[model samples]
Target chain A: MKKSIDAKKGKGPKAKLSNDQLLTLYRNLVRADHFDKCYVRRIQAGQLISFYHAGEGGLAPGVGACSFLRKEDILWPHHRAHAQGHMLSKGIDLKYYLAEHTGKTTGCCKGRSSYHWSFPEYGVFGTSGCIGAGFSPTVGWGLACKKNGDGQITMMCCGDGGSNRGTAHESFLMANNWKLPIVYLIENNGLAIFSKHEDMHPTKDIADLAKGYGMPAVIVDGQDVIAVAEATLKAVEHARAGKGPYLIEAKTVRIQAHGVGLPDLVDYTPRSKEEIDELRERDAILICRERLLTEGLLSQELIDQIEAEATQEVADAERFADESPVADQLDLSDINKLVYAE
Target chain B: MREITLIEAIREAYIEEMQVDEKVFLVGQDIRGGNFPNTTGLVEMFGDDRVLDTPISETAMVGSAFGAAQMGYRPVVDFMSGGFAYVAACEVLLQSAQHYFQHGGNVSVPLVITAGVGAGLKLANEHSVTPHAMFLHHPGIKVAFPSTPYDAKGLMKSAIRDNNPVCMFWHLALMMEKGQVPEEEYLVPLGVADVKREGTDVTVVATGLQVKHALEVAANLESEVSVEVVDLRSMEPLDYEAISRSLEKTNRLVVVDEDTERCGFAAELIAQVVDKSFDLLDAPIERICIDNMPIPGGYLEAHVLPNPAKIETAIRRVIA
Candidate 1:
């Protein structure tokens, strides 16, 4: 049965985005959801063998926040679903990304990196396999931008689990002390692997920690694209104005298992059917679809067309990856080749 | 030629490198204030932007250096003492050491980490330790342990220019040791060994502060044994060819290291020699190293650390 897009009764928050931008943002969210679904199917079918994290309910914040960044700005991403959406929105080729996942020679890191990939030309500095490991480096990027007088800002993303790391506190202290042009976007999905935020941390809101660091912070609804965009834009402006780093905590939901169907091993998700249904109703894609429909901005046919286009794009990427050449076999002498650059 | 201390030579290298390349910057704790003598006056010359002073967070500072290197900047990090490396081991090993190969050789980390090692200042175990063995065990980075002021300046210059991560270990006791350094620009290429004193009876291979002791012991034993001292300036890309040549002539080997004797540089060097040139050896090799124990403060440090007397004893034992 197809789920209907039910527009809420009363008028919602004023649409801060244009019709065209809203359409673009909606299309990106749909694309990320479709890509994640395709990844799960491929993994189950044994066609793809790699770790996967579904960014089902958090696409709005990922797309909205990343859309404001310019080509000169840098992004330090985490190793999860939001990073994929952020990279795809920033014009990183899906074909190359897919090829990388399949361990092809033409991939982003030439099949070397499975998840922690860097596309520097697009200002995606890279992601680290270790959680919160990129925080300090993000500050360094901001320092470089300031030193070069480039007027560029750095947007670093972390999950609720990563925010609790000591590296995060150290980075926050340094960024505040140096007044670096950086925006620390904490995508609080309420759970870190299996533990909820309440169980993991004492604070009610992660942004509250920013006050202790002497930096401005805000908490926004992760499901609302317009709210995320407004909050991110304000943070970006503050950093560009040389006022130092700003922290934004976007409260969202992790609607799927941490990885691709490892539920038998460990699953902390809501088990009841009604609870899962309630969580599904709050899906960012569905909410955005309902808003667009009620605002008379887009029709059902247009939404279906946009979603179909995204599915086709993912198909083309999978085909490209399937036909791409695998990495060459490494010889004993090859071991010494990459140890040193010189 | 002008004579300068090892610290002065290192400072000169920093100044010259920073002047030549605008991308080269110094970032660490107390660097701007010149708390470490090698970084003195650098902030005054390069200004605050180029010479940065970081907080007391070693992990964050080292991790930032790694990030800056990835972003096309050459960052020279000052760790103050080698013992502090334990605090940032994750950054050094997981991030910096794995950056090159992790990205499929797409990125190069041009980072130079300078740290003081060895025990002589009564600073106890936390401040004094020769941890080059730990770094040498890692595959990605280049390790340089310079004994003389000339090698210190040359090796540091080379480290700054090389498109790879390099760790230069400076002995705290050798900081004020004076030696003649050429006024003109020069760089002693890494991975090359220098023979401080040549002999034909027995070969004593050493690194860092141990090289000075080995040279002295070789000089004093001229009448009893002809001791050849090979200063392995770089530990990672060891001078195996030089070691082989020395072994062919001397037929006896004595390895001296400041690290512990078990599974340390001395053990590795002996194993390599035994594997490559075992037939050329006239007798069993001798090793002079600190026993398996923590370096304590005060005069006990002198008893644990290898000295000229220990090097001499090892040389005589090997030649006997």
Candidate 2:
């Protein structure tokens, strides 16, 4: 039996973004794509050896979910692309992010963290290297926001595979019981490393788990940035109004292997080249560009400019990272002092 | 000074800290109704908002603490029992412990974890296991196991005020033990050791309930063997200087721990002493512990769990 996909609405009629908003979405999508592509290129060239899960094919969910977030809104980035795409969309320092990836002293973490970027100054808490580590903390942050009576919302990101974990169940219960201002954005790429999501999860949609805890949620086209943002905006509004948590299950696809240097096989069945080509038919960046041109939201010239600027931005970040010095002996000698706060 | 049990001391510390700091809160299972006598009236005093009663979800509880700590709230998480910490091992042992170091040292996880450990309760394998060794092995967290009501109150207060993650364990056996606690505020300070009894012939170092056992053995052998009893209040930032200073006077070492024998706190203590103060030792060091076996059912635990008899024998062997 074919499971029907419904773009469930929450506290609003069919939501829509203005032409300018659509254009901004396109701009963000293009920038995220550039960052992801550069990340893949860097890994392929062996300029960096950090453990990474590429965010190229699965960039739309994070980019869209973060589109409406304010500077004060807290975010726990997903593991893919070292979370650079979400960081870029959320307005974090791009140079420090890249520098951290390359293990330079000017990095966001001062070269201490290899594949993590935490800019708490900008309200972006570095997601844990362990999957689903963000679930409970997001609830913690949301509880704080609700208690403070502030309109800040916490966007907690996790893969579809991690939705079945214990933290997910427990976090959902607490958020619902307390009516916290949290948005659980579950990005379903249909794979957990090599294990198929279908085999691991009993439910068809990850948001169903949220529903079990009496939490409100929606299912959207993961490849459509505008659709995701529109849905996320309604969820955010509901949360900002103190209506517990809202879950979003984005049915996306993993275009390649889980991480660089890992097998491309999904549960021992190799992902065919044809399969990847078919998945790219809905390339988020390309789709957004086409929509902007078709809807008269943006001209080809403007689209070209956006692409060029994003490319240049990524290039400048690469140069900044490459030029930064590696952390030296002095930093290593301060290990004891670094671990604890005096 | 007021006489109180270890549990009462811990409760008083929580009440005092929460009274002074608005950001300090308590979260655990059945804490509001006071599943244990310590937290019985906390909810009524602080209200449900601060004294959070959570479900049997260790991960979410710890995660909430970790998250609240990130937001500058000092959260004291009750695992109910020491073994329950393993249920959320990733949060307490890894993520929260390593957060500050991995996230550029700017963030502080000012959270306190308290749970009871030791085999006297007779809850069998799962509940009786002493899980402090794993926390001690992890670098970024502080491990403080108190042996007396006085130290328990002071250490709990210090752990609550600390800006780092601290795992504190009290022996279930010591819950009834009474000691003098000050009426005013005082902190034992994390990572500092206290010499429970001063002597001159041999040094017996112990932790948690074992400290009491070691102290008992020292008094019994007082006239025959001058035993100096040192209580290592905190295991992580061990007071190695204090240990070495005691060893300098006694020239013999014996460690008593109620936890496992191998790769546990006792082993770490001996390894550190041999490395830093090997010249101060005249006789080979001795360790009295549960030799690599889980604490069996109630009555059977005596065979494996370290007791006063084992400690006394170890002290005699160390000075033999």
How many residue pairs clash (N, CA or C atoms closer than 3 angstroms) in each of the candidate models, in the order given? 0, 0
Instruction: Provide i-RMS per model in Å.
Output: 1.4, 0.9
Task: Give candidates' CA RMSD values in order.
Answer: 4.5, 2.0
Candidate 2 residue A339 Cα shift, in angstroms, is 0.9
- Candidate 2 residue-wise lDDT, B216-287, digit = tens: 888899889999999989988888999999999999998887788888888888888889888998999998
How much lDDT does each candidate structure score? 0.82, 0.85
lDDT of 2 at B9: 93
* Candidate 1 lDDT tens digits, A1-342: 111111221113333667887777788888878777777777778666468787777777787788768887888865567377788777777777777778888777788776667688888766667888878687678888777776788889888999999889889988888899999988888877777788889987888788787787777788877677767887788788888898888888777777877561123545566655787788888778888899898897898799789989999999998998986665567675767787
Error of 1 at B273 (Å): 2.2
How far is A72's C-alpha from truth in model 2 (Å)?
Answer: 1.7
TM-score of chain B of 2: 0.98
Q: Tell me what fraction of the real C-alpha contacts between chains A and B each candidate also makes.
A: 0.61, 0.70
